[model samples]
Target: MAFNNARIDAVPTLCASCEGRKKGICSALDCEQLVELAKASRKSTAESGATLLGETEGIDRYANILSGVVKLTKTLPDGRQQIVGLQFALDFLGRPYCSESPLNAEAATEVVLCSFTREAFERMMQESPALERRLYRQALDELDEARDWMVTLGRKTATEKIASLLLLFARHAEPPEKTGRHFARFELPLSRADMADFLGLTIETVSRQLTRLRNEKIITIENNRLVIVSDLRRLKARAGNS
Candidate 1:
């Protein structure tokens, strides 16, 4: 009975059953603080392809993604765009203390956000050192991911890039098993064009690499979206992680 109660505590009554609360920065707050924060938050949803924040958009709020995927793009004035990053459930979105967004954030799939005014969040951070520490750690994690992805984009081959993208989605689908020996399934958040853009490959290169992986018995594609990774060990090995 005690273990069951502890399990139930994952969904404390102070807020909706958001994974963000369990794994996100909200975990830094106690129940009373959660209630206070809730008073200033509003739940909102964005459809796929909706722009959550545009480049240079005035930043007024911060959000914790509750579900689905958000893609970040870096763009040029000439209309060229590169998909720079992706965010998933329980990830914090938006830059606090910044007046403008440096990248465009768009929904790659339907998304839910628990968002509150930046003023309210800043006040909470000032009052709670724990929250400030949590935000700092989240920012550090983002920096590390960005560095790793830079290697993937700059050094990985076409096949390696495709496998790396699939491996990323697989890890996001569930905590990656040791050596990734376990199977995983997830529908891709981005289309072929978006994947190409994100991986710095052409659409034809992405498609050809996917075909190679399929023929090699590493993964299977269905309905042009659903992906089942069977050979995760091989897939990870091919992802060029050394």
Candidate 2:
């Protein structure tokens, strides 16, 4: 079938279920524009550890994360790997005009995405100035975040790094409510090994820091995955947050 002729009628329903629709790139689109865009898109789910894109591969599609977390990693020819970034719900997952992926994006937890073919997405961007503006804003936001993380990786101690990571997850998982309370309870999306990769530390060091936090009564672990923070202020102090 011709790519343009493959339009489906399910796009509106799909957009209705997407949490990212209101906050992501699609937010710039009106109802009519959204339905039109959706006609050229589809919904997909990836299991934990599934690769959404590989380094140096052609960019076939762009995706907006609907749920769960994705880890972006870069590797050297010598087999060294580093976790470069993490994408959460409502985050866009691909470079718009770029032809190839610069890094690998893998699901750190099971994830659902709204997938749009690159050609269709680009065409929409050209037609909708609002969409283009929205994408540009997102690009700038991502650049700012990357700069902040570079500082964290370069200057923070291992303990401080772990604490910072935990605080990031807490903020992402449950944003503070209007009640002005700061406690958070959520599962750690990345495994210990993944956390080590993200934090530029060894797995043993990550484990040790987690233990120290628990010992200090800063955080409580209900299981291997779940974490509860009773005093966010203390956690932030441990993270070296001024």
Candidate 3:
């Protein structure tokens, strides 16, 4: 996709409220520091399924999700691929001290990101102990999530795998109360091929399993998006969770 060259300030966002809201890293930062960091950030957009950075790419900048989701994927020599991480709004990007990226950071959907040069961002982090501490916590949390996904992909049944993924989407999504039952409605950010890579299944299997879920009244699919009519507890049971 051709990228638009809009200025950073021209990008739309509510700086102060965003810094104080749920699912936002800014909420954890002091106002003065947040203001300082904001001044250094630049905004960019990526279309759905765009590769923002590849494994072979040198790390030049650090980024944070201003909106939409990103997928961190690794490919094996034999062509096998796995999505190791999913980054949502207010999530960090680029390993702090790394010179080269180990995986591809792709936009799972049309996304807006706030970026900073790697060297400057790292130096700033060093000068700001509170920011550095928060980043450390973020890394640990991401590692824990990676481990959890590994377990799901390795041991879960196809149905359970899909259910777990759906539940996670629900957990990260905006308020359900505002949209009524339609709150469960949202597009799958990644394609079935990407889903297969993440779930350790073939694309055909993923498609079939999704159909089976709908056939069993577990979910409904329309235009490739899913709607979960059942409560989360039921979905978790389908996920084989105790």
Candidate 4:
């Protein structure tokens, strides 16, 4: 707690190096405010397959994803789960003022999060209009992404859908290590089954489409998980995206 009793121009130590502070809504706050909020914050990690929030789970805290991917899933009464969306690094993890989570949020990869009490977060939102507006903008961005996904589901062919899914991960997924090349490289975070569920395709169809992409040289698969998007322009073209 070096910054505890003594005040300086710096943010709290815990938040000084947080990705959320640089890229998320926390960027809207100044040093003093970050210090105040940091008092209520804690950093934690979850392995892949860990559930961060469940449907009907009471809202106790809000978090900013520090790293890795989180999938938001909606379950039907018949016991089917659909991956509705994904949260990447620096994405905010809770809905302000919501009493409970309506969907289940689970880690799609090993994840790091910086979480703070709901009251503290809400209080800060009230005090910092910038932070509040930032969150609102993020919500709107998610809505826009969802609308785009609707087009993919309703109009795209199976190959286009597979390409779209791969491009989706390419846009958000950060590989465990950097390859430092001209083209985009990422590890497919979801399994074939989960990807099938996300894209409304059968497991066999997903696999077949992936094989097609590999044969076309648009992408290279190392093992079953690591994917290197060799030609992003071609990949984007295949996905029917700009």
**Predicted structure with the largest lDDT when compared to the true one:** 4
Clashes of each: 0, 0, 0, 0
lDDT value, residue 120 of candidate 2: 86
Model 4 error, position 138 (Å): 0.3
Q: Over the stretch 171-235, how does candidate 4's per-residue lDDT look in tens digits?
A: 77654465544478778889999899998999999999999999999999998998988667899
Sort by TM-score, best first: 4, 2, 1, 3
For the record, the alpha-carbon RMSD of candidate 1 to the native fold, in angstroms, is: 5.5
- Give me the runs in candidate 3 sitting further than 4 Å from their true place: 1-14, 19-23, 78-80, 176-183
For model 1, the stretches where C-alpha displacement exceeds 4 angstroms are 1-16, 174-181
Provide the TM-score for each candidate, comma-separated: 0.90, 0.90, 0.84, 0.93
Clashing pairs in 1: none
Could you give candidate 2's per-residue lDDT for residues 46-136 as a string of tens digits? 9999999999999999999988999999989997878999999899999878999999999999999989889888988999999999989
Model 4 misplacement above 4 A: 1-8, 175-182
Please list all clashing residue pairs in model 2, or write none if there are none. none
Query: What are the per-residue Cα lDDT tens digits for candidate 3 across 1-242?
Result: 23264323322244544532344545545544455566677778899889988997999988878778899988899987778878887888788788888899999999898787877677678777867887888888988988888789889999889888877776666555655643465567878888887788899988888888888786877767756555556666788878
Q: Regarding TM-score, does 2 or 3 come out ahead?
A: 2
Model 3, C-alpha of 144: deviation from truth (Å): 1.6
What would the TM-score be for candidate 4 when compared with the true structure? 0.93
How far out, in Å, is residue 31 in model 3? 3.1
Clashes of 2: 0
